[model samples]
Target: MDGSQGRKTRQVVAAIAAGGKVGRQKDLLACGHSEWSLRQAVKAGMIMRIAPGYYALPDADPLDLHLARHQARKTCFSKAAELGLWILNPVPQPHVAAAHGRPVPGCKVHRVKGGQTLMDILRQCVGCGSELEALAVLESAVVLKQCTVHELRTAFSRRGDGAARAVIAMIDPQSQSIVETAARYLLKKVGYNVQGQASVWGVGHLDLLVEGILGVELDGEKYHNTPEGWAEDLRRDNLLVINGVWKLRIPAAVVLYNPDLMLLWVERALDRIETASPR
Candidate 1:
């Protein structure tokens, strides 16, 4: 390529690195990459042409590629999960904010915040997700220090009572994981006195303690996969039992996928613990 073309290509690359997306006529022109230079970069495999006017880096995230190709911005459930915030349900489709007519299938569509602000994305999440789901995202965000409880409360105040109020009232920044957050939500929703990250004398920290009687463990797959971890978990459970803390270990999958069944098991365990208690 010529020196001029090289300079333009460098400009294009900088733009992509800054915004993760490059638009042909718009961004290329703004970034000093002419149509020919854009073509040269594409031909040289320096960048990928996603849609008619959009370009992505060769190694861009597939989801972002899809977003650029579809001319949409990720928001709500999609953004929350992508940001590593806790959410109760798995996103069935990427939630996107787009111009009124542009809709991506297998993704929820919102007409608000087509190119969103951080607050706009979070507020949209509060509006889009269910009460429990919203709470999970908010709690995770606060715990991760991405957003503060005061910021969330302010955002909720702007939106008025309903989902935001519901979420803010129950948000727990101390909850460890999405699974742990979901378990707490479930137990709370069912009117159980659930305390998260409760310390037990012999077993370290229980995932949750319900009514100060039943100990609950929410085991993630990664932690329980190895033999050493499995044995350690067994040892912990045995110690808890020996200490007379009636406990139930629930898998993360059951917590995420089959919360009702998990709850039923908890209720049954509680019943057994209650009955077995000295009168």
Candidate 2:
């Protein structure tokens, strides 16, 4: 292939490999495209933005997703340099953050030397790059068997940046179902605070709780679909309501696809609960 064509091929390859998740920027640079080229590709719809500087080609096959993830990783490094936050996810760091030019004051922001950043994280990590390290830390914690949402909540003080809040908002507790996860994120997205797998006095483990009003149930096939499961679900649900708990049981499918309808349902539940409690 010609030089220009060969370069285009590499850029495309990187985006595919990222699984719409992560990638390498130096490879794109090696392909003869500058950072601007990657940005242009995103603007031109040649690829989708995964994070701040990362891009993805979509999920079609190995060839497609692989390149996407690879390209996203490169952007992670570039974004790290631009934002001055070192990423510690995707891979571990050798040195400290203060060594890499990160600001160190009351808190030491250890720069992991750019392995994963938000802009280079999952192919749709929108928001500022400043919290990219935090995202990496969170993702890594999960992979390393460190509970993500809990870790972020504890041992965590905001870094006095807007991006920190965004990352925290986007992070959700470990969910058993993507539908339930999406439901919680969307609910939070719309301004309704929610907690996952919460324990209610009567219901034991609920799929989701909107602070105090709404109850969303992700109907996992093993638990909520079978006849025996259904019988028990009814039992628990009845107990919740009879005990003066105002709630609505939403299926996993509705939570994932028809979220607007779910939100509407949430509004009604909230009104009912608010009227009952008045607090």
- Per-residue CA lDDT of model 2 for 84-162, tens digit only, reads 3324332332222222454433232333444443422322222323344455434443534544555554434446434
Model 1, span 1-279: residue lDDT tens = 889878878777777767755444575676566888778788888888888888878888877877777777678888777678776777788888777646676677787632566677778777777877787778888889998888877776853656677778787777889899888888888999999899987678988999999988988888888999899998998898799888888999999889999999999998998888889
Q: After superposition, how far is residue 230 of candidate 2 from its true place, in Å?
A: 1.5
Error of 1 at 139 (Å): 1.9
- After superposition, the stretches of candidate 1 with alpha carbons farther than 4 Å from their true spots are 1-11, 14-43, 49-53, 59-66, 104-107, 159-161
Clashes of 1: 1
Any runs in candidate 2 off by more than 4 Å, and if so which?
1-165, 275-279
On TM-score, the candidate that comes out on top is 1
Query: Which residue pairs clash in candidate 1?
Result: 93-106
Q: Which candidate is the best by lDDT?
A: 1
